[model samples]
Target: MTDVVSYPKGDLRRMLSVLAALESMPEATLVKLVAKTGLDKKTVSNLIIQAGEQAGVQISKSGPIYKLENWGPVIKRSGAKMALTGALNAPIVLA
Candidate 1:
């Protein structure tokens, strides 16, 4: 049996950027964002799924649109420290 290594949490800026981009274009798929964000497809996909669950963001597999449902608290806490320096409005782009 091979040992499985756990990856660190993804950059939230990348997540939010992807989400923001998704807001404008909901038909973008995880694969597309993976290439756009320069993150591994699996990592980006998992982060997107996690964000959906934590922020109540609904993502349709058939389409690229994602709706943020009650995401105030989740977005606030989703790895903001590294991306934002004690501020939410900072323009930090995660890769």
Candidate 2:
């Protein structure tokens, strides 16, 4: 048997992007897309779970696959108010 290795640093923002990308793809391709993040597999997996929770998204894992649940509504509401008000076009930063 070989010892397992893990990624030391994880970026939640990157994980969120990965989740958004996966939302439009088939479940079977999750692992492949996550791998492209260049994070250790286990690290990426855990980050996915944590990010999902923070965003009020549900996630499940079976064997090597991870799935998101009810993420659409959560994503839709995230910036809806800002979008409607054209906040995205304004140059504003939170302090």
TM per candidate comes to 0.53, 0.49
Worst 10 residues of 2 by lDDT: 1-10
Off by over 4 Å in 2: 1-12, 72-95
Error of 2 at 51 (Å): 2.1
TM-score of 1: 0.53
Candidate 2: C-alpha lDDT: 0.52
Cα displacement (Å) at residue 89, model 1: 6.8
RMSD in Å for all candidates: 8.4, 9.6
Kindly list the per-residue Cα lDDT of model 2 for residues 1-95, writing each as its tens digit.
Answer: 22221222442344544565455455635567555444456766666666666666766667756666666445553563344234657322211
Cα lDDT tens digits, model 1, 32-92, are 6655556667776776787777776665565554444344555653454434343556544
Candidate 2 TM-score, true structure as reference: 0.49
Candidate 2: lDDT of 92?
Answer: 25
Worst 10 residues of 1 by lDDT: 1-10
